[model samples]
Target: EEDQGLRFLQAGTALGTHKGMIKIPVWDCKKNQQASCDLSHRKNMEPVPENDTGQPEWDEESDYRACTYCKDNASEYLKHYRIASWFELIEKTENLASHMIQRAAAFSMQYNGGNLQLMCYPRFTATVDDLMSDLDELEGNLGFVPDLIILDYADILLESGNDERERLDRIWKKMAGMAGKRKVLVVTASQGTRKSLMSKSIKTDQVAEDIRKLAHIDLGIGLNQFVKEDERDERKAMIMRLSVMVKRHGETPSEECFVLQNLGLGQPAMDTYSFLRELADSWALLILTLIFLGVIGWAYRPGSRALHDDAADVPFRNEDPEQSRPEQSRPEQSRNDHARQDGACK
Candidate 1:
């Protein structure tokens, strides 16, 4: 019985046994034009054509905006862009994964010992069916099914124009179905509604196009920040709140606060200074309360009774001198009347 229990424990403790690779298929949509442009600049190549009219010839196959590089050095630029796009995608995914791993470590989850692999698909444009087919191919090549899939900027899969909400809902539902069918975790992101941009904190309702998207997600987290207008110095750290809008396995509708070390990237770190400041404020308020009570006690002390009485009577100290003199003279006149009565009786 002891040996059997030891074996069972060992099996359970085995690391990376069921762990699988994380595959991210990045869709290099037109939304990432700036990143592509930056890549071209780094390669000392002009991404945009600058003719006399300063416009590149439209290439409908490549979705228009085909620059001179695409026209002249098509093969070379294609290879370069593909490589650069993959690098950009991998870098971002790794950064996010690292951040997540750090957070998980705090909860005593040893993700570092897990079998994690990153696979990038650059310039991938395909329908849901095509994506599944490609995933099948990837499984065949890798000899095992992926446990996690990330579709970067998943909204780009939607068709442009006309009933965007309906289209987004359909796409998200299909993605959710894929997750269920594959029995794998599918992670994607959607843009927030315009109103969400102005909001200090975002909720499931703030998801762009359709709030119905929340129904499909097992877990959803919203990142929010509110920068005060007076915080002119960029060096000053800002606070960001991460709210768990949806959760299936654990607690939902929870929030945690962190200070942003880099506002541009919105990287969060513990705000020790803010914690200390709050502690100081609490101590200051307690000290002030004690001082106020002490002052009150001293003012009403037994030794201060005469002083308090005099202070209380100070309000009537400015009475008219003529009015007071009249009262004193009436008392003397009453005594004199009594004396005169006695003399008359005698």
Candidate 2:
């Protein structure tokens, strides 16, 4: 809707009644002249009661002049009278836009956090290269990998049974592995066929149930609900698709909502499983390394010349001549004493 001031300016009229007295503001159409309110009736009105000797107090707020009766609706007149300029309007608009963008960014960061990585899977019309490029863009917005991702218009692949479906399945299967630490949500419209038949193109019930177990949200809207027969059925189909997409993927346009849930808690579960496996492997390696190092140290040990000799080798040291010199010297002394006694007897 157009602003009220803008509307009044365009129409060039302000309709107002004060206490049953009607006043019409007149604007000079000839020139952009300044407008002033005619206070003839205000002059007729009695003044406030005060002491005869006392002067009426002046107020800066009340001193401001009101708009003229004639040009009250005139844009130029209102601009001057209301003290609103075009530059001020432009400034307000810019500030409002900035505030809105900042608010959206803050809310997204608060809810999703930085740990969550968000990805988008557009329709099969997008190629692998296209997907990768889009992924880069998404990462730029998030500043990190997303813990959750959305497959937008996934039904497009279902339409084509060949390579497109294969590619999507492959990608999604890989994504599911990551889902232990992250999540992937797919959004699509439900087919209007009979639910009794197991062959409906869109299995809304089954997908919803499965996704719920996976902790992914699925929202399906039936196409038969909206009444837009005046336009092409494609229009109705598009709306159904869009509504389904928004409910499951979040944010109507892909550009608008780029954030995904962080799922940091999911990481701990993945870490626990990984850590146990790593710990087991590490324990095995540690035992093997200790045995190998012990054998090497035993083999490389200084055999006989070590500072601390082995107990088995200490016997050889005791058998050495230098180690038994005291016993050998005692035998020599007996021989010398025999020789001396024989010489003395002679």
Best by TM-score: 1
Indicate the residue-level lDDT of 261 in model 1.
Answer: 38
Candidate 1 matches the true fold with a TM-score of 0.40
Cα lDDT tens digits, model 1, 1-346, are 5443333333333221122332222112121332355444243332422234432222223332222232123333433332111111112333323344454354234432334433334333556776788778767875557788888656777444478787777778889999999999999887677777566567677888789888888988776654444321212323355666788787674434334433223223423122233334546777889999987776666655424444543323444434545454777889989998999999
What does candidate 2's lDDT look like per residue over 1-346, in tens digits?
Answer: 2343333222221111112222211112111112222334121122222224432222233322322322333322332231110100001122223343464455456655665443434445654345446656766875665544554443343233455435445544434444443344433332333441332123345342123322232344323223332322221111111222224455532211111111211110111112223334546677889999986676456653222434444433435434555555777989989998999999
Among residues 3 or more apart in sequence or in different chains, the pairs in candidate 1 whose N, CA or C atoms overlap within 3 Å are: none
lDDT against the true structure, per candidate, is 0.51, 0.34
TM-score of each candidate structure, all chains considered together:
0.40, 0.22
Distance from true position, residue 183, model 1, in Å?
1.2
Give the poorly placed runs of model 1, Cα more than 4 Å off: 1-124, 158-161, 230-239, 249-251, 259-346
lDDT of 1 at 125: 55
